[model samples]
Target: MCLNSLLFFRCLDALVHFKHLTSLIADHNPITENCFLPPLPKLDLLWLNHCKISSLFPWVSKLKESCPNLQHLCLMGNPAAPSYFNGGTFYEYLQYRLFVISQFPSLNHLDDRKVTEDQRAEAQRLYKRPFFERIIKPGSGSFSQLVHSSVTWSGFQNKLTTLLGKDKPNDRNLMI
Candidate 1:
C-alpha cells in the first residue's frame, strides 16, 4: 500500500499481511472479486486463474507505479464474460500497454498459459452448443477440439436442426 507503515490488517475477513507479502495465488474461488491486494510493494508473483472474474487480467497492472520488483503475474481461465474473453472465445494476447511490464521492466514472465486439447474440448462441450448438437453431430475435430470444415460444419448444423427438440435455444429457430 502507499502508506508507509499501516502495520497489518484484514479486508472482508481476508488475511493480508503487508510486511512480508511476496507471492499470492488464490485461484478458482469467488472471494477474489472482493479481495484487494493493496499495491504490495514487495510482491513478486501473483496468480489469479479461474476466479470467475469478469473484469481485469493480471490486475496487478494497476500496481505498476509502485511494485517495481514484481517478476511474475498470471490471470488465466476467466469465463465468457465480455471483459474476460474480448471478442474471441479463446484467450489471446493483450493489445494495450502493459503497465506492470513497463514498471518492472525486468518482469519478463506471465504464467497465464494456454490450455490443453482435452481442456478445450471439455470446455466447448460444457458451454458452447447444447447437448443435442454434441450428441447428434459430435464435433468434427477431436472431441476435445471443435474445428469443422465448411462441409462438416454445415452437416453439423443440419444435424443440430434435425435433433433440436422443443427446448432448443431461441437462435436455432431462425437458423437458415
Candidate 2:
C-alpha cells in the first residue's frame, strides 16, 4: 500500500487494521518517530525515501521494536540521510566510518543494497554511544537513579525475561 505525497500526513493510525500488510510506501509524508506507537509486525518492506525526516537514528531505533520483520528500507533522499551519512559520503567513508546498519540489527537491505556483515559490525562498534544513551538516559532523569531503582530494574528484568520466554527468579528450575 502506498500513501505517498500526503504532505500534511502526521500519523499512521489509519494503518492499524492492516495487520497483514507486508509492504508500505509512505514516502514524501511528514511521518515522525511517534507515528509508530503501534507495531506493524508483518511489514517487510518500507519506503520512506524523501520526506521531512530530520534524523534517522531515533526513527530507526523506535522502528526496531515496531517493525521487527522489516528487511528492506529506503531513506535515501530524506534530510536524515545526510545527518546519518555526513553529506552522503557514506560510500567514500565506508572503510573507516559506520552507517545506518547499526541502528537496526535485523535490517538486511538498506537503500536497495544488501548490508554487508563487515559494515554491520563496524556500525555497531561506532554507534555504541547512541545505543547506550537510548538505554541509559532514555530521554529524561539521571542514569544513576534509573539504575538504582529496584522497581524499575525488576520491571525491566521481568519484561526481558518474558520476551525471551524464560522463567522469572521464583520460577527457575533449580536442580540443587
Candidate 3:
C-alpha cells in the first residue's frame, strides 16, 4: 500500500513477520514527532535519519529482538541522537550498550556518529518546548529529570567531555 503521513506507521505495524525494511525516509511529515518505527520482526538496515523523534532509541531494542541479522542503524539530524560526543561516562557507555544489547544486539554500524553543538542546541530546543515536557511518560519527573535520565542529554556535559576525551571506541558485543 502507498504510505503517507496518516497511514505509514499503521501499515508498517500491521505487516506481520517483516524481514527487512531499509531506508525509511519519513521527513517533512507530522508523524516524525513521535516514535514511528515499522516494527519489522526480522528487519535489517534502518534509516531513520533526520526524523524529529523524541524516543530514547526505543526502536533499537525492538529491531534487535526482531532482526537477528541486522546491521546499520541510522538516526541523524535529531536532537536526541547527538552528532558529536564531547565526552561520555562509564554510565553513558553502559546505557548505550544496554539500550542496544536489549534490541540491536546484532547491529554493526549506527550511523550519524557526530554530536555537534547545534544538534545539542536543537535537542535543547525540543526539550524546552511545553508539549514535550508534559507529553512524555509520567513520573519521569520534570524536564530536568527526564533529560538527566535520558542518554547524554541526561547530564554529564560537565565531566563527560573531560573524562572521555581519550577513551577508545566503545565496541562491546552485548547479548541481551
lDDT pick, better of 1 and 2:
2
Off by over 4 Å in 1: 1-16, 31-34, 57-61, 79-92, 96-104, 112-176
Off by over 4 Å in 2: 1-8, 83-88, 91-99, 128-176
Question: For residues 1-176, what per-residue lDDT tens digits would candidate 1 score against the true structure?
Answer: 56635433223233344646788776665534435555567877766666655544444344453456667766565542223454532222321113223334545465453333444444343334545445444544464454342347766667666655334654232110
lDDT of each: 0.47, 0.65, 0.47
Candidate 2 whole-model C-alpha lDDT, 0 to 1: 0.65
Any idea how many clashes model 3 has? 9
lDDT of 3 by residue, 3-43 (tens): 55354442244445443554444443333434434456455
Best to worst by TM-score, what's the order?
A: 2, 1, 3
lDDT minimum window of 10 residues, candidate 1: 90-99
Best by lDDT: 2
Reference-based lDDT, residue 55, model 1: 42
**Candidate 2 vs 3: which has more TM-score:** 2
